[model samples]
Target: MAHLGESIDVDNIVPERGDFEALPAGPYMVQITDSDVAETKAGTGLILKLTMEVMDGPFANRKLWTNLNFRNPNATAQRIAQEQIKQICDAVGFQGQLTDSEVLHFRPMRVQLVVKRDEQYGDRNEVKKYSALNGSAPPANKPQPQPAAQKPASSAAQRPASGGQTRPWGNRAA
Candidate 1:
C-alpha cells in the first residue's frame, strides 16, 4: 500500500488523450531511431525491424515501422529486402556492412508509405519505397541490374547475422 503526500483535486484533473489514427500514406522524412534483428516464429528466417520517427512536416514525431526479410529462403523476398537496405545505406552515405547494433539515427531519409491490408489483420503502414533526401538525386524506382561479381551492400554476409529471439512484428510473411 502507498500513501498520498497531498490531497488531490479530482474535479480539476483531466485525462490526456492520445490520437490513434494512422498518418496519411505519403513520402515523409524519417530517422531510424531503433533497429533489431530477430528470427521468424517458425524459426526458418530472420528479419530486420526498423523503427523510424517522422522528422518534419505535419506528421512530425509520428513513428513508422518497417521489416526487411534478408534471410528468407525465397529469392524474391531476399532481393526486395536487399534493395530496400541498399537504398537506405546509399541515402545516408553508409558503406560496407550493416548490423542491428549500428546507430542509424544520424540522418533522415525519405520513405514512401503505403497501406497494406490483410483479410484478418486489417490495414497498416508499409514502406513502399526509399529515396535520398532533398538536394540529393532520387534512386531509380526499380533496382538496376547488377553484375554477379559486384554484390550489393545488403549481401548475406553483410546483413545482421544473429539475435536472441523473434521480434513481435517479424513473424508476419514478407
Candidate 2:
C-alpha cells in the first residue's frame, strides 16, 4: 500500500485542475522517458508504448505519448509501426537491429505533433514524425529516399533496454 505521509485537509485545499488540454500541433524537442510492451486490444499482437517529455520551450517537461504496434494482425498496421520506429532510430543514429527500446531514450529528438480531433473523443496530440535536433532529418511528411544498402554501423549506441490506466488516443489508422 501507498501513503501520503500527512493527513488530508480537503476542505482547506484549493481545488484547481491542471491543464489537460493538448499542446498545439508543432514540432517539439522531446525525449522518450519511458517505454513498455503490452498486449493489443485483440490479444493478437503487442504494442510498444512510449512516454515522452518535452525538453524545451514554454511547455518544457510536458508529456506526450505514442504507441508502436510492434505486432499486429493487420499487415498495414504493423508495417506502419515499423516505419515509424525506423524513423525514430534513424533520428537517433541507430542503424542496426533494435533489440531493446531503452537505447532510444534520453536522446533529444524533434517530433512533429499533430492535433487530432475525433467526434467521440475530443482533441489529442499525435506524434506524427521524429527527427534529430541536428536538422539532417528529412521532413516528416515526405518519404525518405532509400540509399544503397550498407552494413550496420559498428559504433551504434548499444544500451540495454507504462502501466496504463487508459488506452492512448493517438495513432489510429483509418
What would the TM-score be for candidate 1 when compared with the true structure? 0.64
Best by TM-score: 2
Q: What is the C-alpha lDDT profile of model 1 across 65-88, one tens digit per residue? A: 888988898889889998998888
Worst 10 residues of 2 by lDDT: 165-174
User: What are the TM-scores, per candidate, against the unseen true structure?
Assistant: 0.64, 0.71
Per-residue lDDT of model 2, residues 1-174, tens digit only: 889999899989986544556899999999999999999988999999999999999989998889999799999999999999988877866654576788778878899999998778678899888888986754332334434464334423221111222112221111
Residue 110 displacement (Å), model 1:
0.5
Leading candidate by lDDT: 2
lDDT of 2: 0.77
Deviation in Å, model 2, residue 134 alpha carbon: 2.4
Q: Can you give the lDDT of residue 71 in candidate 2?
A: 95
